[model samples]
Target: MGWSWPANPALWPLARELVKATETRQAAKSPLPHERETVAEIRHKTEASNGDNVDRTSAYLTFFRKHPEVHWALLAHLVSRNAGWSMTDLRGELLPRLLPANVQQDYFSFLERGNWLIFHDAYPQLLLYEESVKRQTTLFHLLPELHVSVFMQAVWNHFWKTGDSKLLTVGLIMNEQHYLETHMMSDETYQTTVVKTLPFALQEVLRLNLILFPYRAEGQEDGALRLAGAPVFHFASLAERIELGKRLYSLLFTSLRLREGAIQWASDKPHTGSRKDFWPHLFHDLRETAPGKAHQKKLGGCQLLPGANRLYSPALRHVWKQVRHEAPKAADWYPATKGVMRQLLLSREQPASFCAEEAYCQALEKIERAVLAKGKLFGS
Candidate 1:
């Protein structure tokens, strides 16, 4: 059966309270009561004042100053990380306890609000939250147990070929999510990667969760499942970022659901409809238009500078790399040629250049076509 999750709009005063509490925190020089060594104080003290660390701090403070409501997201990041939040756990114990099915509609609400905000440093409070380390370490050890429990409930999506009830696996086949959409593997090797890698990804999630919140219960695990610890090519002494470029290109091809100049994402299923009902509609007007094969939407700010970064638990933002039910057109592939090269060259000066982003996407497009043959042969 296709999964279905109906929307549970806000019922409890959680949203309102969260907003008010956050506002209070931001107003008082953005410090906690009894908080020592403030961000402002630290900023005042730090010698290194350039790059993302400095820039994000400035943006972080300025963003909060303007959008105090964003504090809810910030708080969510802190609480979920410390609480060791897990979607599987929530469905099994936490949600039922925090909000039983009997009272779910009354006390808790689940909304598929896509990626929340643009990427930015969420660690501005690390200095104030002294207990974060102890809390995260405790959570780290709990991963193995959580892993077993979570794995037991996992629903493999036509990927796992054969498996016993004791050990289920998404037996990897060469799928579009892989290198140029083509990573052939023996069943043995594929399963090994799945086994060794799942836990690694989980650990990565925990580490990332400490600083960001990837809410699996919210169906935000797609990116984590899709992406891996820096691709093997990252360490190779290639002249240019050949591996990184290919991975990035493949990622763009398999992940994004490009829309009307905006990136269409397969959001976490809400508590409103079947996952099936929800998914098919995404590509309808947004990703696919009439005369579908001619022109494809370009990946731009819609993807790279997503607004969801602030809305999602910060951890989710990090794993937002993997997406599902992607629909890339044959026309979407590339020219990793001079364009991508040019973008790479220019990116040093322009951190987030549309040209650079587009070039990589085009590169992915080229690679996909080379591997999969314009997606049409594969009936894209």
Candidate 2:
């Protein structure tokens, strides 16, 4: 049977209170009463901040200055869709109110041009919060036995969501020797390159439970189910998320510059035997560190960047190469591209450029034609 998640509008208030109380109790555990008091005060302030007649901009500015972490929690509320804040509201009002003028303008310009908000720095806190909520409510609770609470928090989504509300489920595939692996087993270059970087990604996921899923064993005794997907983590309150976001935002900025500089530096150097192999690996490393979908959205202010042809073509080629014998012509690949591209366009600050628009449109057209061709061949 297919899966579906029906809206539970009635649960909003109950869920909100549960989240608040849980957060407060967790905060009170701190040795310092001041920390606890600050948490409590923030909660009260949050209640007061939601006034219909009051100026929300001023309220947010003041609240943000004092309790920046609240932004993470509030964002979680927005992301979870337990509250009414849409992407439109976030783009139009909340973002400018929180971010600096220059940052806001840069992002706004990007949004004005059609682009996908998939990069890491462009994420809005609200969207990150929503993904976190979904991860927790769906995956986390599913595995109650595993204690992954420490890594679960509001800011983790800064590392997750694809800026298009397309949830990313990361799997850190490992082998018996504790080395990382990918599907490209025969290719030595792909395997070696993936191995080197896989550990870092694995460590990050393990440390925070930010990105997690399960993989089943090939051969299991009596179908014991060797691997079961679990809930990664859960944050105590929205405040923690905001605090986490501040820390992560700074780190993300540094990481981006370092990556750009490395790419430039590698390009300048003379390549020898090992360096030839290493250079491409360096690009792979850069891709790993590249900002996630959420960051791209908020950073570009909602720009619709072009989809990676290199990425799409390879997938299409792989499917055609591997499965063409069974399904001579299949349309499965096109929908993924169409859906992602459409989402990217919708998230863009403006329509894409002529070239980019034409390319994606053509890509879409090709996929549609492929689907039709398959339908004619199969008569299904």
Specify the highest-lDDT model's number: 2
**lDDT at 160, model 2:** 33
* Candidate 2, poorest ten consecutive residues by summed lDDT: 171-180
Q: Against the true structure, what is each candidate's TM-score?
A: 0.19, 0.17
Tens-place lDDT per residue, model 2, 1-380, is: 01112144432332343354335435644234643443344334533433211122223233333433333322221111211111121222123233345543333232211111111111222222333355453222211111112112211222232221211111000010011111122235433443234432442344322211111223433212211111122222222332333332222223434223322332332221111111131112112223222222111111223542111111111111111111112111111121211111111132211112223233323333443454457542
Tens digit of per-residue lDDT, candidate 1, span 107-145: 111111011111111222222122223343211111111
Candidates in order have lDDT scores of: 0.24, 0.24
Candidate 1, residue 173: lDDT: 10
